[model samples]
Target: MRTLKFLLQKEFRQIFRDPSILRIIFVMPAIQLIILPLAADYEVKNIKLAVVDNNHSDYSRQLVSKITSSGYFQLQHFGSSYKEALQEVEQDKADLILEIPSQFSKDIVKENEASLLLSVNAINGVKANLGAAYLRSIIQDFNRELRLRWIQFPRFNPEMNIETPSSNWYNVHLNYKFFMVPGILVVLVTMVGAFLTSLNIVKEKEIGTIEQINVTPIHKYHFILGKLIPFWVLGLVVLGIGLGIARVVYGIVPVGSYLTIFCFAAVYLLAVLGLGLLISTYTASQQQAMLLSFFMMMIFILLGGLYTSIDSMPPWAQAITKVNPVAYFIEVMRMVVLKGSGLADIKYHLLTVLGFAVVLNSWAVLSYRKRA
Candidate 1:
């Protein structure tokens, strides 16, 4: 116990003394938490639309007005020729081109139908797909409006309409920040825990301090605990700072208890720090530790459902997330923050991360070599 206390003092002193480490501990989370959620938005908007109107009729103009007014599109180029609109797409001025053929209004009024062509810039696939889909929906709505205006209901044949209204649960405004901030908080905490701990022991090795520690009668687990505890505490500190920022800046307060968040975070840090310690045991230098940590963290964060849906992934990718500790915590954060989940709801997540902490810390302790 005495040995572990002394070691904790040394680690804390070393961490505070380094300006770079101080920036990582305090500045990184503040900057990233403030900037990332605002930038990393999944909702696509402001798509540049080019229109080629041949008929110059009221119906065609109304259709164009309907699309632009929907707020998803910007009318970048409005020309009479498809070739000119195509030029806008080639010159990168437009994302999509809507060509209304000649006699469009005539066909719609006389034949009750009209044809239109959509040319999309497929280079940006997601934006192109969503933009085209948005335009199509607006056009369909215009068609329905036209029918409702021209045809008198209950006069000749009554038209049946089925309205399906949707309620957005948890996120009533469907704020992307609400969905992204908690997950980003998880990522920031994971990076701090894993990166710092992985580099801690390796820095000791490079600086010849491990030799001095090995000559002492300290147990391997004691040394590991000393390395783990300070950073584990810092990891929670980062979580607190992040949560406070979420509340003040973004107006996000967890629907669940703060105690629940801390409880999961405590165990989650053990697993993350244990992984870091395991990496440190295998690595001999700070550079090696950092590169390895980055490599593993990239895979973990990408597969952890931060930006994409895990359910949409392939069967094998889904299998990989089951073993990923990051995935578990991100899911738990969303469950607790957005869904108001309690400890009982997160028991499976807690137990899984607890298992990860046990396996990883045991491996780290066993792998650390003490040489006199």
Candidate 2:
């Protein structure tokens, strides 16, 4: 116990004395959490639209006005021919094209039915889908208004229409940052924790201190715990800074218990720190440890479902995520922070992360040789 305490004291003093380490632990994460969510947001908006009004009728103009004023679309072009409007989409100036055929108003007034052609630039598939869907919704709303005014005798019997009201749980306003911040924050924590710990023993080896430590009376577990505890605490501190940034800059506060977040963070750091320590045991220098850790972190975060949905991934990729610690932490962070999930809600993840922590630290400890 006494030896471990002294080792921890030594590690912390070395950590605080190094300005570069301080920057990775504090400055980098603070700035990134503040900035990443802003740029990585997934909520698509400002879809450019080209309207081709062959009839130039009042109803066609009204439909265009409804679409443009709905805030989802911007009027990029209003051309006389479908060819010109299609050109706008081909040039990438427009994401969607709305073409009203000849006698559009005449058809609606005389036969109570009209048709319009809609074309989308499927280059950016998600943007195209969402933009087309938004335009369709606005056109549907306008058609309902037109029905209310033109034919008062009930077009389809309103009493029989099925209206589904959807509630966006966790993110009521659909704020992209609210969805992204927690996941990005997890990456920040994982990178800082893993990179630093992985480099710790390697740095010692680089500076010719590993020889001295190995010849001493310290146990391998003591050395491992000494290296692990400092960065583990620093990881939590970084999380604290990140949470503050999430609140002050982005107006995001966790709906779940802070205790829950902290507890999961503590255990997650164990896995990350252990992975780093294991890498350190194999590498001979800081540069090698850093490069290897970077490569591993990239793979982990990419598969961690931060930018994409894991369910949408290939079945093989989805299976891989089952063993990915980063994926579990990302899930737990979203579950607890956004959904206000209790321990019961994340028991599977909690147990999974616990398994990771146990296996990784034990592996790290065993991988370290007392006499090498």
The 0-to-1 C-alpha lDDT of every candidate, in the order given, reads: 0.94, 0.89
lDDT of 1 by residue, 1-372 (tens): 888889999989999999999899989988999999999998989999999999999999899989989999999999898888998999999999999999899999999889999999999999998989998899999998898777775663326666799999999999999999999999999999999999999999999989999989999999999999999999999999999999999999899999999999999999999999999999989999999999999999999999999999999999999989999999999998999999999999999999999999999999999963
For model 2, how does the per-residue alpha-carbon lDDT over 1-372 read when each residue is reduced to its tens digit?
999999999999999999988987899899888777878957678999898889988898888888888888889999788888888878889899898998899999999899989998998999988888888888889998887677644555544546799999788988888889999999999999999999999988888888999999999999999999999998999999898889899898899999899988898899889999999999988889989999999989999999999999999999989888999999898998888998888888878888888998899889998787
TM-score of 1: 0.97
Badly placed stretches (over 4 Å) of model 1 are: 155-162
Question: lDDT, candidate 1, residue 9?
Answer: 98
TM-score of each: 0.97, 0.92
> Residue 310's C-alpha lDDT in candidate 1?
100
lDDT of 1: 0.94
For candidate 2, what is the lDDT? 0.89
What clash pairs does model 1 have? none
